[model samples]
Target: MTRVRRGVVAVVVLLSVVLAATPSTVAASSVTDQLIRRLNRQLLYMAVPIAVLVEIILIYTLWRFRGNDEPRPTRENRQLEITWTVATALVLLFVGTASFHALAHPSVSTIDGESSDVPDDAVEVDVTAEQWEYAFEYPDAGVATNETLVLPENRSIYLSITAEDVVHSVHVPELGLKQDAIPGETNLLRTELTGTGEYRLYCAELCGVGHSGMLSTVEVVSEDEYEAWLEDQRAGEADNESATDATNESSGGDEP
Candidate 1:
């Protein structure tokens, strides 16, 4: 029992240390990322000590009371039992309060509220997901793309996410942003990009066989460069529309 307990303690300690050393890197692109990272660290701090203490107590009890002799019933120490129970309850209360405070925080939970944490000049992008692909549309910019998502860095973005087929999840790990895209329901998420870099966007949910292929890039560019890209997309779309219109008119004349 002592050996088993020691083994458990060693494994637990090693895991705890490793996790603490390599905590998830929060990009801190927005307030939500900061809140999430803060909460994670706080929980880790609380959990490690409690876990070690509990393991120690369990091992000591097993070693001290080990035997196959005639089972002798011992009277319960009510005060000791009460003390430990109360201690456990207090720990739970403290952790619960902390979790609730973080979850109820305004910056983390008010994604769709009327209150304006988002800037007035924030850009809006409509995100649509299907079984195996993502389509991004910038209505204001008159540009849409299926292969890549381009946005201006250091600016707030309001994302309107929806699914064309089954439910999907949109996740941008660098920004620590994720939102569910459900059919017939539009979910909104707001965040700001803190730097200009390429980030990977993934479908966090398993939609189908091609879910592994449901990958794309998020390119955060300067405002001027973003505008230029949008202009080029708009021009290409105009040319395609004109060519389609001409083709239809020529086909109609030939049929007559």
Candidate 2:
């Protein structure tokens, strides 16, 4: 019985080691993902030891009092039962406290602190989604870009998102972010790109026939490069509205 319990514990430890060593780290980060992962990882971490202890106790009890040789006692160990019940409650309480802490992190309220919880001094970008395009509005910069979104690294940027037509979700996998854009209401999210690189921005929700082409690029650049990109975007007619108008004008389609 002792050997079996030891083997099970060994396996658990081995698996935990492998999981911790895996090279799945390093990527873009968002507030929602950060909080959820932290809370869930902590919960599982707390559970494993308790589970192993319970298994060992159960195995010993089963082996010691088997069959008629040790006729099952009718009396219950009320004290032991009460102790276990209190332990279970304590575990649950800890889980709740940790989870609440994760949720309460100011970052969870919005991306990069555009929400009421975070200071309003951060950069704000208005992202509007249509059938197959992601049009971003940098109100402070007076620039809108459809091809690529240029963001500054290390600083939190808040995104206020809405749909121009149907429902859509903006997702930047490397940034550890995703949020829905509804037609009537604005949804917000915060993220900080840790490094300088070009990442893919995708529409996670379906909209229409051209939804597959609803792809955009996320470019993380230094302060100077970001400012230059903003200026260039402001001077170009790369917004979704301009593209749609040009298409309709060429085809002589219905007026807007």
Write the residue-wise lDDT of candidate 1 on 117-200 in tens digits.
546788888899998999999877788889889989777778888899998988887677788888988877876776788889
- lDDT tens digits, residue span 1-256, model 2: 9768866876686567546644344442555556666676787678767666766677667666655575755788899899989988999899989988977765555443236754555778999898888888888878876778888877778889888888998888766677888888787777655688887999998788888888998888988888777777665745666888889898886644
Error of 1 at 216 (Å): 1.8
Report the poorest 10 consecutive residues by lDDT, candidate 2: 21-30
Where does candidate 2 clash, by residue pair?
28-174, 28-175, 29-175, 111-189, 111-190, 112-190
Candidate 2, lDDT over the whole model: 0.75
Error of 2 at 190 (Å): 2.6
TM-score of each: 0.72, 0.73
